[model samples]
Target: MVHSPLKLDTPQEWDLSDLYTDFDDPRLVEDLDSLQQTANQFRQQYQGKVKQLTPEQIVTCLQDLEQIYQKSGYLYAYPSLVFAADTRNTEAKQFLDKVMEALTGVDNQLLFFDLELKSLDSEAFSQLQASPALKNYQHHLIRIAELRPYKLSEEVEQTRNRDSLTGRQAFIQLRSVHLGEQEYPDVTTPEGKTANTEAELSALLYHPQEEVRHNAYSAVRTVIKEHNLLYGYILNAIAQDHKIENQMRGYPSTLQKQLIEDQVSEPVFTAIMEGTASRFDLFQRYYQLKSQEIGQKIRICDLYAPWTTQATPPLSYQSGVELLLAALEKFDINYARRAEEFFLKSWIDAKVRPGKRGGAFCAYSHGKHSYLLLSYTEDYNSVFTLAHEMGHALHFAWIDETQSYLNSNPPMVLAEIASTFNELLLLDSLLESAADETIRKSLLTRQLEDQLNLLFRQSTISRLELAVHQRASEGSFDHLFINEKWMELYQLLCGDSVELLADHQYDWARIGHIFFKPFYCYQYTASNIVSLACYQKYRQVGKAFIPGYLELLASGGSQDQVQALRQYVDVDLEDPATIRGALDYVEGLISQLETLI
Candidate 1:
């Protein structure tokens, strides 16, 4: 039987029985116990003996580590998936809390093995890599040696791990809990005061009516403003935490080590950041043209407002599945088949309900099923989100079949490629089959705006991240200071195209990335640029490029971002032309929108 689209106005549910039958599932406790025991056993066997082991013993250690990691995945993801679906559930929260402590202990037990490996000198690591038995493990060892240069002493490492629960994690939980309990009234829709969470408020920013949209933004801004002192203190503390850690680790700056971890050099990161800024003209031109289309000056709140005269009707969940599945079919039969399973096997939770976490994410369990959490609103945008997460599912599915658990984690810089690629395919399919000029125009506009969002807007926030982190290091990350500093970034990012209001000053206060992962926004720009290169190849070479792209995804972290891309599509990120691909893609999108108008 075919199902209908999940209407957000009502409660819709997703089944998690595939992973666990219930909160008290017997397997939950068993899995946790198994992980703890396994970790202890592995540590006892090889913790300090890593360097002394023969090449064959090292292979055995890797095999054991893989099993341990795969088991931990099941244990960690169960409570995590439950908590995300409804953060207010007390039992779910408790389970997650207990599981985290258990996992942390397990991680500490296994920590010595990694620390010893990372501490190896270049010559020692080279000799280890020279083992033919460790041939497939070269990239993993190289990464260890590369990062070990930034490694801490055993004493410092232990203290850092133990203190995380009380330190960084406590601050993160504070923000998460506040957002969960906090509710705002949707003041725009008359006689209408619904209990709106932050997620609902943010989603309403896309409402068709201009007043409804801006009102949502206003309501959120007001709420955040009232709690500015608390939020601002939390933000600064997180930044301060990072700055101190960077200093103790002997790094030059905070983001420098992050670039290193992503296997991207500082120069490449710099070129992409500077290149996106140099083309701020395109950002201005798009918005100025949008303002003309809407017959008013664009405001910061109106940035996401749909400008098309008539948007296509709300896309249903059933139709969304069919649309995305059909798009995947053109690439490979296997890709389409896996997407079909998402609908047939009840793998997706397409719903809008209370207590659910905001935003969408795909988590692929080691050697098991891939789960996705999304608050589907049944719009053109929501359908693409489904496609996007499904892309992540498929990305891991390929890797699972071809790789071991040790090599399954792809770098964040390359992680967004599959998901965004799915969006591209779905968008092109919709545009190709669009019934009229208005529909086509809407599709084109969304593509352009999203491209700019991922490429340039993320870069702008990255700029904000750098500024705030630097200021925090100087003891100046205050509420008023953040407002003024963010305003400066606003002018740099938007120029004079969009009107900035007082409410816009506190917009940075709502950005979670600054608190969660400092200097991480640039990954979006990097991945989007790489995805564009992949998409361009598909368009140029047609079906012939499908194998290479799938092969790239299957390689996972076995190859670094640049190495994997070179093998598949010859994309050299360090090359100026490849970095400019992002700029060129935005310009192409703007040109397309111009012709449509």
Candidate 2:
């Protein structure tokens, strides 16, 4: 029988030294003042003089801005991540909110400079691009210029940014107080014990017993249903807010605004959607096989059931890090080393304690350090989760060292490539190293399950989102309609393989990404397909692929994702062939699994 870790087990605190001496360290003040002074002077020198500045001067301005922004980013990221780890901490939250306001005040003053620069005549802008350094930012400048058509008066734009922080951001914060901190009822287990919180409740669902899964699922669903109105209002308000903004921005579709921010095209996104949806057979078939393996007909609720294997062996902190580092070594020695550094330096916050947020994420702190937050499970999935988040951490680390501040993060769409790629490598390594056929089949099934969730399941959600937004555009948008549509998509995919339990119908309530970011789910499919395509090249091309991949990461926000991805790896997202290639790879893997099974 499996036993839970004892409560009050101390979480290893991450070393904050890499960020600063402390949140109130004198260097932070010094740097902030220096940044403000430079920005103030930068505005004076280039405010009206941008069109007339020499190419050298423009490059110099870009460089200075990059440096200052990078430092400020590091400053902000540290505290924000710390606060996220302990959302209940009043002091950290207040301090972070204040710093955010102060920093926003200074940064708001400089917003006009870029908009004004983008307004420069073509000839003058062309002259500024003569320098190699300035030329490197041409695409970056061009994107800034693309906003010209939608540009408001400088006063209006500035007002919007400030008002957003105060009005919209503040509302979201207040809403979080209501929704984020709501006390979920204790999840009663089948053994007649109540889990302390939702995190523990979620952990218990992975119990090998079917009764535990059913009870946990029912209890969680009960809480969500009890609070459905509050959650529904939050979701609808956010979606409506996005829809209105997209309209005002003249974006062609609800997601177009996000795509523009992502620096990708509509057709490419369509290809990702179409290509991923076309491969539903792979997921359906896997679920079918999994259902048979589990001795029950699979249904939507059964998607996350645990494989009967050795119970989660007690994996100490060091052992977890060593296992991840060892698995990562197969991908690249450097990646392995970087992963090790993240652990050794305490870059991760893995204590599975109460009141901390559930799930995992890598917070990029620009130039300082990336922080990972997870209620770490000692199971195989947790190992994969660590590897996944580390992929993001490593990507940002490389970008932080190489790119300027404005260029540190790629769009969220491409951002997942590295993370998912890491997952693939870890899964492949574990599969290869498994000791027996049963274990191999289990690993294979698990990997396939993840792919189904990330690829087919996520794409299905994205398509439903697109449909909902389109209906909203026509003024027929309703939450009930969205929930109904979601159920339809779920049934279409799961059909006969799994029973469509009634509680499973409200699954969309749990997917925060959908409520938080419109059309964000498409990226999961995009990242997986892109990773698959890139992985294929890496396998066939050998060491030659690494340089280009690094170059792509280094390029960061300096170039659009499509251009950077194309220039480096040359995977055309718009091409049917590329999508077909990825789908075919999945089919081949499935065929291999079928043989083994």
Best by TM-score: 1
Q: Tens-digit lDDT track for model 1 on 537-570?
A: 8999999998889998888878788888888877
Clashing pairs in 1: none
Q: Candidate 2: minimum summed lDDT over ten consecutive residues — where?
A: 1-10
Q: What is candidate 2's lDDT per residue for 1-597, written digit by digit as tens?
A: 112122324436667778776666888678777777877887777677777677777778888777767777776776677676776767667867876776776677677678777787877666655567677677767777777666666777667677766665665554544444545556564456567555666766666677667766776677666666555556666666666666776777677777777766788888877777666777778778767666877555467776563444445555556666777776778877777777667778887655565567888777576888877655667777888899898888888777767666688767998898888777777777777876687677677777777778888888788877777677645456766887898777776776887776566777756665777887888888888888889878877898888777777777777767889998877677877887888788788877865
Cα lDDT listed for each candidate: 0.80, 0.72
Best by lDDT: 1
Question: What TM-score fits each model?
Answer: 0.95, 0.90
| Candidate 2 TM-score, true structure as reference | 0.90
197 Cα displacement, candidate 2 (Å): 3.7
Alpha-carbon shift of residue 589 in model 1 (angstroms): 2.1
